[model samples]
Target: MAATGQVFLLLGSNLGDRGQVLTSAREAIAEQAGSIGNQSAIYETEPWGITDQPVFLNQVLEITTSLLPEDLLRIILNIEHDLGRVRYERWGARVIDIDILYFGQTIMDSARLTLPHPRIQDRRFVLAPLTEIAPDFIHPLLQKTSSKLLQECPDTSAVSKIP
Candidate 1:
C-alpha cells in the first residue's frame, strides 16, 4: 500500500469576498483531498510578480493525502475553475489561487507542476503563513526551515497577519 504523505498547500484570493472565497476553497479541499491539518491564519499581502493587482489574502494548509503530484494538480485546477478563476495574466488579480507547496519532501520540476514551489524562497507572502504553521519544516531544496527562510527572505513585500 502506498503511504499517504503530508502535503502543504497555499491558497490566496484577491477578488470578490476574499475571505469567503478562501473559506469555500478550503471546504472544497477538505471534501476532495485528505483531511486538512494545521492551517495558518490569513495574511493580507501585497501582490508579487505583478504589482498593480489587488492585495491578496493568503493562507497555508497542511494536508495528508495519497494522491500523486500530477493528480493533485488536476484537482487543484478543477477547483480553481469551479471557483471562477480565469487566467488573464501571470500574477494577475485572481478569485482564488491554489498552489502545491510541498508533497512529502518531493522535489520535482515539470512543465505543469513544480514541487517545493520554485518561488517560495523569494516570496514573503508564502513564507509568512508557511512559517506560522510549519516553522520547522525544512525546505527540500534549500534545506532551511520556513521561519529561517522568512527571516532571511529579501522580498520586501508587506505581509500582515489578519485577525
Candidate 2:
C-alpha cells in the first residue's frame, strides 16, 4: 500500500445507543478505509441547527487511508446507513453521523461535496476534538488554526469531554 492519506472526520450520534453507534462507526471507518490513527475524547454537546432533538455525543478522529475523498465519503455514508441513520432532515438527530472534516490539506468544493467541511470552524463538536489532535491545523479557507477558530466561533453551546 502507498502512504496512507491523512484525514480528519467528525462522528456523532444522538439516537439509539449513541456511544455504541459512535464506536461502531469508528470501527467501520477503519475497516472500510485503511487504519484508525489518533482519536479524540468523545463529547456530549447540545444540539445545533435543528433543536428539537436529543443531545449529541460527538468526537473527532485522525485516520490514515488510501481512499480518495469521494470514495471515503461513500464509505462513510454506507456506515451511516448500515447503522440506521435516517436521511430525513438537515442537521437532524441521527443514529450515526459521520462527516469528513478534512482530507489532508486539500481544499475542494463541488455540488456533492466540499472539502474542509464548511461548518467545521463553527461547531465545537468538530473543533474541540480537532484542537486536541491538531490545534495548529490550518483551515484552508479561513487560514486560521483550529485553536484560533475555536476561540472565534460564536457558538456557545456546551460541550463536555468524555472518555
Candidate 3:
C-alpha cells in the first residue's frame, strides 16, 4: 500500500481580506484532502518578485494526506480559484495564493511540479512559517532543515505573527 505523506503548503494573499482568504484556503485544503497537522500564525510581508504590487499576508501549513503530488496540486489550484485568485501575471497581487512547498521527502522535477520548491530557500515568507511548524524538516534538494534554511535565506522581508 502507498503510504500517506506529510505535505507542507504555503498560502499568501495581497488582495481582499487577506486574513479571511488565508482561513478559507486552509479550510478548503482540509475539505479537499484532509486535516492539516498545524497552521502557523499568519504573517504580513511585502510582496516579492513584483514589488510594484501590494504587500501580502502569508502562512504555512503542514498537512498529512494520501493524495498524490499531482492530485494535490490540482486541489490547491481549485482552492485558489474558489477563493477569487486570478492568474494574469507572474508574481501578481492575488486574493489567495497556494503553493505546495514540499511533499514528504519526494524530490521531483517535471513539467508540472518540483519538490522542495526551487525558490523556497530564498523566500522569507515561506521559510518563516515553515520553520515554525517543522523546524527540523529537511529540504530534499538543499539537504538542510527548514530552520537552517530560514537562517541562511537572504530575504529580510518584514513579517509578523498574527492570531
Query: Which candidate has the top score in lDDT?
Result: 1
Which clashing pairs does model 3 show? none
The TM-score values for the models, in the order shown, are 0.97, 0.95, 0.95
> Who is ahead in TM-score, 1 or 3?
1
* Highest TM-score against the true fold, candidate: 1
CA lDDT of each prediction against the hidden true structure: 0.92, 0.88, 0.88
- Per-residue lDDT tens digits for candidate 2, residues 1-163, read 3545558999999999998999899888888876888889999999999988999999988999888888888889888999998899999978988899999888899887899899987887788988988898888889999999999988899899985
TM-score for candidate 2, residues paired by index: 0.95
> What digit string (tens of lDDT, one per residue) describes model 3 on residues 34-79?
6888888888888898899888999988888888888889888888
Superposed Cα deviation of residue 53, candidate 3 (Å): 1.7
In model 1, how large is the Cα lDDT of residue 87?
Answer: 97
Tens digits of per-residue lDDT for model 1, 1-163: 2645569999999999999999999999988876798999999999999999889999999998878888889999999999999999999999999999998889998999888799899999999999998999999999999999999999999999999
Clashing pairs in 2: none
Candidate 3 lands at a TM-score of: 0.95
lDDT of candidate 2 at residue 84, scale 0 to 100: 94
